[model samples]
Target: MPQAAPMLRVENLAVTRGGLPVLEGLGFTLEAGQALVLRGPNGIGKTTLLRTLAGLQPALAGTISMPPETMAYAAHADGLKSTLTVTENLSFWAAVYGTGAIDAALDRMNLRQLADRPAHSLSAGQKRRLGLARLLVTGRPVWVLDEPTVSLDAASVALFAGAVRAHLAQGGAALMATHIDLGLSEATVLDLAPFKARPPELGGIAGSFDEAFA
Candidate 1:
């Protein structure tokens, strides 16, 4: 049988922050049933790259090749509605994504007990779990997460890791920027330090850097 294409592919991609290049010449492919952990020092452009991939921002150049609606992004923000209960928040997401029940998501993220509590009433860690649960309700094949374990206890970390493991086992792909070790034995680490963007070469004809690149 022929080899299947990657679930996500980025080739020669360049992205900017504040109108200046941050990550450039980035090329990687993520296949189904696999996980990729992005590793780099703080301020080395991991978040910017992820945001670019998540469609939160436009890439300065290059291509992101993937099937439409295959990606779901969860950022540092929990993205919860303070007035909405945990279950309600998840149900809203499910309806938006046109996915199924939130019960499994609740159990996986250990949010079942707090399902009836308003998001504003939850502690920091609880809020984060609820945010991560949004990923499950998405029902998308690829997960794009940034600092997914910001506020969590050891047990909660384990829950998050288990959720990721199960997601991969089901032929899903995840690309995440996280410092906490998920203990995913199958994950590949991609260090962005090498891919950090260098200032655009001065050609002596520039009005502005962005203009030169443009």
Candidate 2:
């Protein structure tokens, strides 16, 4: 089989919040057909890293190489417009990416029936599903997801895992920061806890936490 191309590459990345370093000297690469999970405790900068990768936050240092339109980001906030219906939200994203069909994406995320319902009227998990449905309408090869499984029930989580597996199988890549265990044995987990910086030195916590989450 032919090899897939690299989807995202981060080199010597460092980020700061409130002028305090959060990630230091971090680097990683994600290729098409693979998945990398960002794992860490709360307040450890996992979300920040995802935001940086998504281009929603600026990196204090280093380079993030990837095409913006070729990337799909599902943030922790659900990224929904309260006044819009679920269908409207998905359709809006579909228009943004200019690829795939909105209805199909909603079907994939199991939100077809809730299409006309206002975003704020849905439950937390339903809103999350709607957020993920946005990605399905995009042809992006790189996925940056933060807490992708926030409020999913057992079946919904399983559905999401299946979608992720399908994406990987199709030569797409995903960078996700999630608390839920994905059960993807082949996934590479990058723990960010130790990478949280101290007050003075912009360095990470002592020791190697890279392999802990793997």
Candidate 3:
């Protein structure tokens, strides 16, 4: 049988922060039900790559081919409203994404117990769980996540791994930038160091040296 087209495709992709190139010549393709883990040291532009793919920032060069509505991005920050209750926060995203079934998301993230608590009142791990829960309600095929397991406990990490597996089983894909092992045996690993951008030649600088640092 013929293979299905990729859910996301990035070719010769380059990203910049503050007008300084950070990543370049990065290429990858993700198929349905697959996951790609981005591994690199700090300041190597993992988060920048994710943001570029999510359209929050523009790529300095190259191409990214993925349907706009098919992607859902979760950043390092939980992006929660401090005053809103857990359910209300999720409900808001659900409405925005045109997806229902908030209860199922809460249950999956083990967040049903804290459903009524204000986001500011939750612990770090709780907040991360809430952020992960938003992915469930997105109903989007591709997930672009940054440091998803940060501040999560061992049990919560396992819960998140299970959620990723479930999403793959349902034919969704994920591209994640994380430092820890998420226990995903089937996910492919992509090291960002190979794509780290070289310093620009003289007279090619786009901004001041201080501004070029990401």
Candidate 4:
């Protein structure tokens, strides 16, 4: 049988923040049944890169190729409706994605216990779990996550690791930026240090003054 194309492919990608380049010459491919952990220290532009991949922001340069509607992005915020109960929040996403019911997602993320509570009533960790649970209801094969483990406790972290593993087992793919280990043994690591962009020069007087002061 012929091989399949990657779930997500990025080539020589350059991403920017506030109109200044933050990451350049970035390239990677995520295949089905695979997960990639983006490893880099703080201020390394990992979030920017993931955002670019998710189409939240435009890439300064290079190309990203993937099937349409194939990606789901999770960021720092839970993206929840404070007035909505946990079940309602998830059901809303399911309806939006046109996927099946949210029962599996509730169980997968351990949110069943808090299902009836409004999102505003949940603790920080609880809210985070609910946010992560949104991934399951998305029904998108490619997940782009930024610091997914934030606000999660040890048990919840393990819970999330299992979720990612399950995603890959079903021929899905994930790319995430996180410091904590999600314990996906089959997941590959991609370090972003080498892809850091050079600092842009300051404008006119400030640039000249800095050069002269040095």
Instruction: Mark the regions of model 3 whose C-alpha exceeds 4 Å error after superposition.
Output: 202-214
Question: Considering only N, C-alpha and C atoms within 3 Å, which residue pairs clash in candidate 4?
Answer: none
Question: Candidate 3 lDDT (Cα, whole model)?
Answer: 0.91
**Where does candidate 4 stray beyond 4 Å?**
199-214
Note the Cα lDDT for every prediction shown.
Answer: 0.88, 0.81, 0.91, 0.87
TM-score of each: 0.92, 0.87, 0.93, 0.91
Tens-place lDDT per residue, model 1, 38-129, is 99999888888999998987887889999999999998887899999989999999999999689999999988899999999999999999
> Candidate 1 vs. truth: CA RMSD?
2.9
Worst 10 residues of 1 by lDDT: 202-211
Give the best candidate by lDDT: 3
Where's the lowest-lDDT run of ten residues in candidate 2?
205-214
Predicted candidate 3 versus true structure: per-residue lDDT over 51-73, tens digit per residue: 99999888878999986699999
Cα lDDT of model 2 by residue, 1-214, tens digit:
2565567889888876544567777888998888999988887788788877878767777898875667888877878999999988888888877764787778788998899999989999999888888878887878889889988999999888888988888788899998889888778999887666665533453323243321
Alpha-carbon lDDT of model 4? 0.87
Candidate 1 residue pairs that clash: none
Per-residue error (Å), model 2, residue 186 = 1.9
Model 4 alpha-carbon miss at residue 45, Å: 0.7
Error of 3 at 107 (Å): 0.6
| Candidate 2 lDDT score relative to the true structure | 0.81
